[model samples]
Target chain A: MNALSTTVGPPAMSRRGPVSTGPNIPSLVGSEPQQRGMGIARSRLVFVVILFCAAFFVMAARTVELSLKKAEPMQVTKQHVTVPPVQFTRADILDRNGEVLATNLGTSSLYAYPARIRDPEEAARKLVSVLPNLSEGHLIQKLSASKGYIRLQQRLSPRQKWAVNALGIPAFEFAPDEERIYPHGRLAVHALGAVNYKNEGISGAERYFERRLSDAASTNQALRLSIDSRVQYALADELESAMRVFQAIGAAGVVMDVNTGEVIAMVSLPDFDPNTTRGVSGNQRFNRVTQGVYELGSVFKTFTLAAALDDGVVDFSDGYDASLPMKVGGYTIRDDHPKGRYLTVPEIYAYSSNIGTARMALDLGTEQQQRYLSDFGLLRAPDIELVEVGAPLFPARWRKTSTVTISYGHGISVSPLALVTGIASMVNGGRLLPATLIRNSEGWRQGKRVIAPDTSRKIRQLMRMVVTKGTGGRADAVGYRVGGKTGTAEKASNGGYDRKALISSFVGVYPMDDPQYVVFALLDEPKGTKATYGFSSGGWVAAPVVKNVILRTAPLLGVAPKTEDEGLYKNVALRIEE
Target chain B: MRKIVTISAAIAAIMSGVMVLLLNIAVQEQASLNRTLAKQIHDDREAIRILSAEWNYLTTPRTLEDRSGQFLALMPLRAKQIVNTPATIPLRPRGQDVDTKGASSVVLSSADKPRKVKKNQRKGTAL
Candidate 1:
C-alpha cells in the first residue's frame, strides 16, 4: 500500500507541475476564473462599442430626417417661385406746368376661374352686390362660361376689392388693369386730348406726344408746359361770358408769349370734359384754336400791312389810291365803310380799307406775299404741342384775284393759332418762333427772320392807331396801351360771300411800344344784338372781350400800370385827330 | 502616472462638450442673418410701391392748379397781356416812388411790408 501511494503521489505531483506550467493546462485548470474575468472585460468593451454604434446610428438617422425635410421644402419653393415677364406700360400725360393732365393708375379687375365656382348664381349675386354697376345677368353669364378665366368686372376700387376679398371665394382672382384719370374736369379739354379705354392718346397734345409718354425706353418723366392755370382760367371765363353775351355758336381765344412763343392760355368754347368722353359731339371736341380754319376777317389786314411795310412797298407815310373802288379780275374790292379817297398807310390800317390793302398786296407781288405768309407760319401748320393743327386754306394757284381777296382777309382761311403766331412774329421784332406748349428750359428757338425791327415798330404803331382811333376803339384798355385790329369777313356760301353770316375776330398786342403778348379772339357766326346796335363786327363782338381780358390780367402778371409819360407809350400811340 | 492620465482625459471630455456648444451657436447666427435679409427685401418692395403712388397723387392737374392759384395769386393770361422781353423792363420804385404812388396802388400796406419774395416766384419769373 505504501509503494502504491508513493507511485500515485509522484505521478500527481508531476502532473500538477506540468499543469501549472503548460499554456492550455493553466487556462483549463483556471478556466472558470479566467472565463469570468474575460467575460466581464469582453462584456464591458462590447457595451462601449455598442453604445458608440448606437450614437452614430442615431446621429446618421437624425441627419437623414433633417435633410429629407429640407429637400421637400426646397422643392416646393422652386415650384412656387414664378418669374413674371417684363413689359412696358403707357406714360403719363401732363399739363404745361408739370401738372398731371392724364395718368394711368393701377386697378385690379376681378375675374373668376369658371370651373372652380361651386355655385354660379350665388357667386354672381355676391359680385353684383359689391359692384352695383355690374348687372347680375352679366356676372352670371361670365361665371358660367366654359373659358378658363372670365372677367366679372373691370377697374374695381380698393373698397370694392376688399369687399370681394372678404367673401374669400377660392376661384376669384384679381387681374391688374391700368385706368386713366383726368383731374382738371373740363379745363383745357381741347388741348389735353382724349384717350381710349386702354389709355392710348387719340387726339390733341396727348396724341402728339404719345410715344414720349408711352415708351418706357425713352422716359417716364412728366411733361412740363408753358400754360399758367390762372391765365387759362381767366381767358376761358371772359371768352365764355362773351360767347353768351354775343349769342354766338362758338368762340375761340389764344394767349401766347411773344418772345418765348409759349401758349399761356388757349380756350375753345363748348368744350367737353375729358374724364367723361361719351355723349360729346364732334364739334365739342374740336380744338378751334388749332384746328378750325376760318377767314378771320380784317385781322388779316395787320399781316397784309406788315408784309407791305417789311417789303418796303409801303412806309409809315406812304399813300395808296383808296378814292376809287379797285376792281381786280371780276371781283370788286370795297371796304364796308368806303372812304372813296386816297389814304396813307396808317389810314389804310386805321380805316381798314380793302381797296388800299389790295393795292398794297399787288405792289408787293405774289412772291413777296408768299414769302411773308410762309414766314408768318401761315403756309404750313403752326408748330404746337397738339396734333390738331390745321393748314391754311389758301389758293394753290396764287393768282391776281386770290392775292387781291387775301389782302383784306377773304380768300385765305387759317386757324386761330396760325393768325396768332403770325401776329406774334410781326410784333415780336421779326423773329418767327414756333409756338410751344411745353415749358422749355431754353425758351422758343429763334426762327427765320421775317421782318425788320423798324417794320415791327411801325406795325405796332399802326395796330395802336386802329385801337385808339378806328374799329378797335372799344378794345382800348386804359393804362395798358392795348393795340389791335378788327376783322369782320363775310362767310362764303356756294362760292359767294354771305350777307348774313360773318366771322368776326380781333388780334391785339399789349404795351405796343415794346410789344410782349399777342391775344386773338374770334366769334364764329355771331349774330347782331341790341347792345351791338345790330352790328357783329370784330369791334362790336371780339374787341370788348380782349379789352377786359388785358385789363384784368396785366396786374396779375406783375405789369405795372403805365403812366402817360412812360416811354413804353411814347412812340406807339398815334395822335388822334379831333 | 495613472492619476496624470485620468486628469488629461477629463480635460479632453470638457473641451469636446464646449466645441459642440460653439457649433450650435454658429448655426443659429447663420439662420438669423438669412431672416433679417429677407425682411429687408420685403420692406424695400413696400417702400417702392408707396412712393410711386404718392408721386402720381402730387402731380394731378386739379390739385396743382388749386395750389398754384392759392400760392401765386395768378389770373388767366391773354395774348395781349404777353409780349417779347420788353426792350426794357420797368423798375419798381424805391422809397420816394412808392410814397408818390397812392397806398392803394401798392399791393402791401405799412402793416404788411413786402417780405422776401419766395424762391418759386423768382424761378417762375426767370423762366
Candidate 2:
C-alpha cells in the first residue's frame, strides 16, 4: 500500500521520486544516491528510452497475437437474450418487383377493467371524448358492471390511440393487434385473397399460403408472387374498358411469360376489395381466370390445328371445304362467316371456319385430340398457386362428335387460365410449362415437350396470319408482329347452344417472330354494340382489348420496337390472297 | 551505474502496466457504444418495414396513375419512343462543334424527367 507497491507513480512524483517500488533496485545494485542534477538528468534520459522500447515491444507482441489468432466475427451474445416477439402475425405479400400487395397493419384494441374504474361516469365520458362512435349510455352501463375485463373498441387509429392515451384512464388497456390490409384496394384482390377476423387466410393466395406466412423462418422475409403491378394494372384497365364498352356481364384477362409459364398478370372483373369482404357477391369474389370454366369458343381452334399439324394429319398447305355445314353424327358445324367455297388451312383459320377446324380434328382422330389437349394442360385446372381453381368440364366419352365440336371449342369447357397456359405451350417452342403464380427466382422452368419446335414456328406463322388478314386483324399491333385468334362460342344451354349468350375471347402472342408473351382476353355475354355494328364476336370485343394491353405493356417490358417496313419474317411466307 | 540501469528498466515496466489498464477502460467504453449502435440498426430496420408499406400505398399503380393523370398531362410511354441507352442515340456528328440548338432541344424534350428512380422496377428474369 505504501511507495513499494506502486506500478508507476504519478507524472509529477515520478520526475523526482522512484518510479516503481520493485524490490529497491538501487539497493540491490549496491549504488549510492549521491549524484548531482546532471547525473539525475542522465538517469531520467535512460528511463525515457527504456519506456519507449518497452511500448514498442508490447505493441509488436499484440500485433503478432492478433495475426496468429483465428479471425472470429464479433458475436453479439444471443445465448441468454430475451428477444421481443414478432411485430406482425402474417408475412407481407409482394409483387415480382417487391411492391407490397398485402401486409398486416398494426392497431391498438382498447379494453378496460371494470373493477378498477373508480368513476364509471367519468371514465365512460373520457373514453367517448376520443372515440365518439362508442355509445356514452352503453359505455356507462358496461363500465359500471362487475365484469373483470371489457372490450371498448376492437381497433383504433394511431391518432385515436394517442388521443385516448392523453385521456390517461388507468383502467384502460391497449392490446397490440394487426389486421390484413391491401392498400392497393381491389388491384389484385383475386390473387392476394382476404383474411378473416382472426387474421386467418380465408380465400385466394392468403388461404393457399397459410403455413408459409405463419412459419417463423419465412415470416420476416416477404412472399413474392410473379405479378407485375404495372403490367397487371394495364391489362385490367384495358379489359375493364372493353367490358364496359361491350356491355358484357363479366370479363377476364390473363398475361403470361410464354417460355416460363410465370403468370405476369390476371384479372377477373367484378372483383371485390380484399380489405373488405363483407356484403360482397359471390360473382364479385369469383376468380374467372382460374375459378370459372367457360367454353372459350374459337380460341380452341388453335389447339386443334396445332394437334393436327404436330401429328402430321395436315400441313399448313392442306385445308377442307367450308361451303357446306359439315355434319359429325347429328351435330352440324357451319362457319360464322362462310367463304362459300374450299378454304385453305390459313383461310379456314383467318376466317374462323368452324367446319374446317372440325374437319382437321376428325383427321387427327379422337384419341390424338384428347392426348394433345391433355399435353397442353387444358383437360385439368391450371396448376397455379391458388385454392380457387375450377375443374374443367369435358365429355366423359371421347367420341367423334366430341372431337369435332371440341375442335372448334364447343363440346367442353375450360378456365381462361387453362386456355392461356395452352396457348403459351403452342408458341413457347412447344414446351408445356405448368402455370405458376410464384416467382421462380432459381431459373427458367423446364416444361414437357408438347409439340415439335418446327410445329410451334408454323403455328406462330398461322397466328400472325390471323392478325394480319384474319378475324384478329383488330389485334395486329404495329411493329409487335401480333398473332392470335378470335373466338365467339355460343353458350351451351339446356341440351342446346344459346346463340345470344356468347363467350367471345381472343388469345394472342406478340412479336410473333420471337414470341415472349401470350395475352388472353374474354368478355362474357357481350351484347352487340352500335360501334361494333351489333357484332359481339371476339374480334370486335376482346381483340382490341388484347391489342391495347400489348401496346401499353410492351414499353414496360422493354421489348425493342421494329419498324413495320422491316421484313424480318421473310422465311415464313404466308399467302393471304390464296 | 548498474543501480540506475536497473531503476530505469523497472520504471519502464511499471509505466507500460499503467498504460495497459488505461487501454482496457477505453475498450470497455467502445464495446458499450457498439451495443447502442446495434440497437439503433435493429430499430431502423423495423421502421423501414413500416415505411415501405406506406410508401407502396402512396405509389401503387392505381394511385400513381390517378395522381399523375390529375397533375401531369404526360401521355403513356410508347415502345417506339423508348431507347435502351443514351449511347444508342449519337450525341452529334463525330467532329462537329457542339450544336447548342440541338443540345438544348434534347434537354427540353426530356425536361422534367425524374433525376433519380428509387423504385425497384421489377424487370423479371426469363424462366
Candidate 3:
C-alpha cells in the first residue's frame, strides 16, 4: 500500500504543479464556460418575452383603430373630388296632401380609372353590354382616352351597376350620385316642371320651390303646393277630350278655388312628360295658361259689363242699341248674332253683344277702361311659379279708337292665367289674390283689395245672368249654378285677323251666389266642325267643355247637388215681363 | 422566515389574478363599443338610402299627376284660365264672405253667362 500511494501522489503532485502555473486555472475555466452558456440562454428568453409583449400591443392598437375611428378610405389616385362644405339639401317636395312631387334618389355613375384597368377592351365591352343606351363608338372613345380617370355614364340604375360590378373589371368603378324623378308621367308636367341630371329644378313649381326643397335649414319640412292632383287630372282629361273632339290645334284648362285663391288644377295640352323632356318641342313645352297670350274675345265681355255696372255707367235697366254695327278704327265690331233691337245691359251680357260691349266701353272712356283693366291685373304678366309668364299686350298709347276695339275683346291679348285670376277676383268677393303654385297654409290669406263687395255681387249677378239667359247657357250645369262668359276671337295672322283661326274660350264660376271656384277652358285655332255646323263659337266649342268638367268634378269635390227650391237663382234670373 | 416567504408569494398570486380579470373586462368593453359604432354607421347609411329612394319616388311625372288628380281636384290648365286680374275684368267686391252651397248648385249657377246658340248649333253636344 505504501509503495502504491507513493506512486499516485507523485503523479498528482506533478499534475497540480502544472495546473497551478496560473492561479486556480482548471476550476476557473470550468465555471467560466457554464456562466457564459447560462447568460446566453437568459438573454434569449428575455428577447422572446419582449417580442410577445410587442405583438400584444400591436394587436391592441390595430383593434382600436379599426373599431374607434371608422375612417373613410384614402384616395389612391389624383382625381377631382368636390367635398361639400355642408350637409346636403332639405326634405323632398310633396303635394298638399302629402303626395311626393319631387324627391332625390341614390344612383351610381360609372367611372374608369385608366391606371387600374388591366384590359380596356374587356371593360368597355362589359359596360356597353349593360348600358346599351350608350353608343359603341362613344364607349370606345371613352375607354381609349389617355386620362387617368373618365366618367363613363351618369345615373346608372342599381341593376346596371350590379351588372357592371359582376364583370369584375378592376378599373370600372361606381360613383355615388343623386337623381330626381317625376313619377306622374305627363299629367302635371307644366306645373311640376323638370329637373336636370344633377337633381336641380330647372322649371315649373319645382324650380320655384327649389330653394325650399334644397335648403338644409328645412331638412325636416316638405314643400307643399296649392295644386290638387285630382283636379289637375280632371282638367287634363277634359281638355284632352276637348282637343280630340274639336281637333283643335291645342287646348288648355284651369280650375281654381275662388274663396282661397288656390289653383286646384292647371292642365295644358300638348304637354311634354317631365320624366323625359329631352326631345320636347318648344310648342309642346309652352304652358298655354301662363305663357300664351291670346285675344280672349267674348270672355273679356264679362269684365267689360262688370266694369260698366261697377262704375255706374250701366245697370240692369240700362239699354244699348245692338241693332247697328259699330265701326271704329276701320274695324266694324258686330255681334255674331245681332239682336237687331235695343238690348238691356243684362241682355247684352247674356247674348255677348259686341255692339253693346263697344258702346259700354265708349261710355266708360279709355282712361277709365285702361285703369280698370290694369286694376284687374291685365296690363302686366300673370303671377305664377314659372319664370315664363306672358304679359298682356295693350296699345302703347290709349286712344278712343283703341278703347272701342278693345271693348269687345279684339285689341288686347293676355295669358289664360291672367284671365282666370281676374275672373276669380270678380266672382270671389273681389279680393285679388295672387295665384300661387305652392300649397296655402293658415297664413296664405294676404291679398290686395281689387273691388267693392257690392261690385263683386253685381258682377256675380251679371255672370249668372249670362249663364242662365245668354251665350254661356251651354256652360250651365243643371244643379251647379254655372256662370261664365264665352270668347271666340279670330286668331291674328300676318298683321290681320284670320277668319279660319279662332281662339275659343269659356270662363265660368259655379254657384254664383257664393262662388267657390272659377274654371276656364281655351281651344287655340279650333276648326269649325260638323258638330257645330262648321261654327267654332265659344258657346259651341268651349262652353260645353266647362259644363262637362263641372258636372264630373262636382261630386269629386264634395259639392252636393242643389234642389230647385234652394232659391240660388232668384237674384240672377232675368225678370220676364208678363 | 418561511412564513414571510409564503405570505409574499400568496400576495403576488392574488395581484396577478386581479390583473387578469381587469384585462378580461377591458376586452369585453372594447368589443361592445365596436359593435355599437358599427350599428350607428349602418343606420346612417340606411337613412341616406331611404331618403334618396323617397326623392326619386316623389319627382316622377306619373306620381305627380296622380297625386294632383287625387288630392287637388285640378283639371288640365289652359292659357285662357290664367288672367291678368287688373286687365280685362272690372273691380270686384272686397270683404264679401262666400256662402256655402252644394257643389252641384254652385256649378250650375256659377256659369251665369248665357251661351249664344249658333244658328246651326246642336243640343247635347259633347265637348
Candidates in order have lDDT scores of 0.77, 0.83, 0.76
Best by DockQ: 2
CAPRI category for model 2: acceptable
Instruction: Please provide TM-scores, in order, for all candidate models, with all chains considered together.
Output: 0.71, 0.79, 0.73
Tens-digit lDDT track of model 2 for A141-186: 9999886898889768889999989998888999987877787788
Residue pairs clashing in model 2 are A444-B127
| Number of clashes recorded per candidate | 17, 1, 129
Better of 1 and 2 by TM-score: 2
Candidates sorted by lDDT, descending order?
Answer: 2, 1, 3
Which candidate number has the best TM-score? 2
Query: Per-residue lDDT for B92-124 in model 3, tens only?
Result: 322223323455532223233235435475533
TM-score (C-alpha, index-matched) for candidate 3: 0.73
Which CAPRI tier for candidate 3?
incorrect
User: In model 1 chain A, where is the ten-residue run with the lowest total lDDT?
Assistant: A79-88
Instruction: Kindly list the per-residue Cα lDDT of model 3 for residues A1-578, writing each as its tens digit.
Output: 23433423433454445434555544543577756875776688679879987997998899898899878787645433333222345456666666666556567889887777666677677777888887777776677776678888898888898898888888788888877665556767788888876677787877777787777788557677777666677778888878888889899899988766778788888998787878889988888989999999888887787777778887777778888888887877778877788888777877788899899999988888888888889889978777778888988988888888787787899999998999998987778887877777763464677777788887887787777777778898877778898889999889998998899999999876668888899998777789789878888889998988888777767565553343644554543111
Give me candidate 2's interface root-mean-square deviation: 3.3
DockQ of 1: 0.08
lDDT of 1 by residue, B19-77 (tens): 99898898678667666666666566545444554664564444665788989988655
Q: In model 2, which regions exceed 4 Å deviation?
A: A1-87, A118-122, A125-129, A132-141, A564-575, B1-36, B83-104, B107-127
